[model samples]
Target: METTMLPAIVQVLPGDDFTVYAYCNDGAVRLLDAKPLLELGGIFESLKDPAFFRERLTVMNDTVAWDIKGNRDETCCIDLDPCVIFRTAPIVDDPLENVI
Candidate 1:
């Protein structure tokens, strides 16, 4: 999948990080800032499915879905407080030293 065809908002199910790469059907790579790719599918596994706005979503627009396999964290709703890793970096005085 080409980058231009990719969707703007992606919601990862569970066990997803920014480093994870989402490969579209047409061979486009998109780096998710948060959990854009749903974690329903297993990690380190190849997922095969049509792109949808949400899981169990019937309407198919330009969103890219997955059917991968591997390790994954199962959570229904994402928590904003506890899941600090997903949130933006905290304010820090040091620029280079504070890198995650």
Candidate 2:
């Protein structure tokens, strides 16, 4: 199956449960859990620090990214592919919906 890349991430909101609320340019929202990735270690190890993990999230290169360099250098940055994230992340209901 051919897979197309999802829209760029416009916003990323961190949650208490190691999940992130990602808003895409296409008007889709998804909840992504980082726990599994964090367990793989390596660069992801730095995310073990809750404060650093939650506060350093950013949207870069059309995907979810983190600036671990503290200086905003690309060298210490990590990003997840939007296509993959869109496919794997759980879909979230739009809170703006009005219910009677």
Candidate 3:
């Protein structure tokens, strides 16, 4: 028997501060911070450039992906696992916190 995978990403919206809001097929929205991942270096190094990072964000194969070449190929593509993304904590902003 084979296990079934969860719903894929339906949409991705890139935000400032290297954050992305992802909407999944499961009817869930998740927030992912790329700051930490960018610190890991390697292929992620290229993403340190905010412009490059934001411009290439896209939803592919039910996951959040970035294709450096914009060709949608495996070689220059970087993706975040949908399962892990779904489990990530969402970013919440409290407007009242700024009030004194």
Candidate 4:
């Protein structure tokens, strides 16, 4: 029998197009396209602003999150499920790999 552990997000980098690079505990860098969620409106509406999206991007509650209130309160922030991101987002080369 085999058991799989859910992925834990360690860091996140937001792209201008609403994509997020989620770096997980398993050493996987997955890319998440957040446009779909933004289309849903409501609380996610605030993230439509590119500046706000990138500025508020953070890792909280073990996943990619948007700290809209500028506070690290998990309950007050919007977060994505790490499991879903791990399963759906394709693994990509680390964007920071070539940084000096």
* The best candidate in terms of TM-score: 4
Q: Using lDDT, give the best candidate's number.
A: 4
Q: TM-score ranking from best to worst?
A: 4, 2, 3, 1
Deviating ranges (above 4 Å) for candidate 1: 1-17, 35-100
What's the lDDT for candidate 3?
0.78
The TM-score of predicted model 2 comes to 0.82
Which residues of candidate 4, in runs, are more than 4 Å off?
1-3
**Number of clashes in every candidate structure?**
19, 0, 1, 0
Candidate 3 structure quality by residue, lDDT tens digits, 5-75: 67578878887799888877766667788899998999899889888888988876668889879888765
Across 5-90, the per-residue lDDT of candidate 4 in tens digits comes to: 77899999986588999999999898899999999999899989999999999999999999979988889999988889988999
Distance (Å) between predicted and true CA of 75, model 3? Answer: 4.9
Q: Write the per-residue lDDT of candidate 1 for residues 29-60, one digit (tens) a residue.
A: 33333334335444412222323222332111
Better of 1 and 3 by lDDT: 3
TM-score of each: 0.21, 0.82, 0.79, 0.92
lDDT of every predicted structure (CA atoms): 0.29, 0.81, 0.78, 0.91
Give the candidates in order of lDDT, highest first.
Answer: 4, 2, 3, 1
Estimate, for each residue in 37-58, the C-alpha lDDT of model 2 and write its tens digit.
Answer: 8999998988888888888888
* Higher-ranked by TM-score: 1 or 3: 3
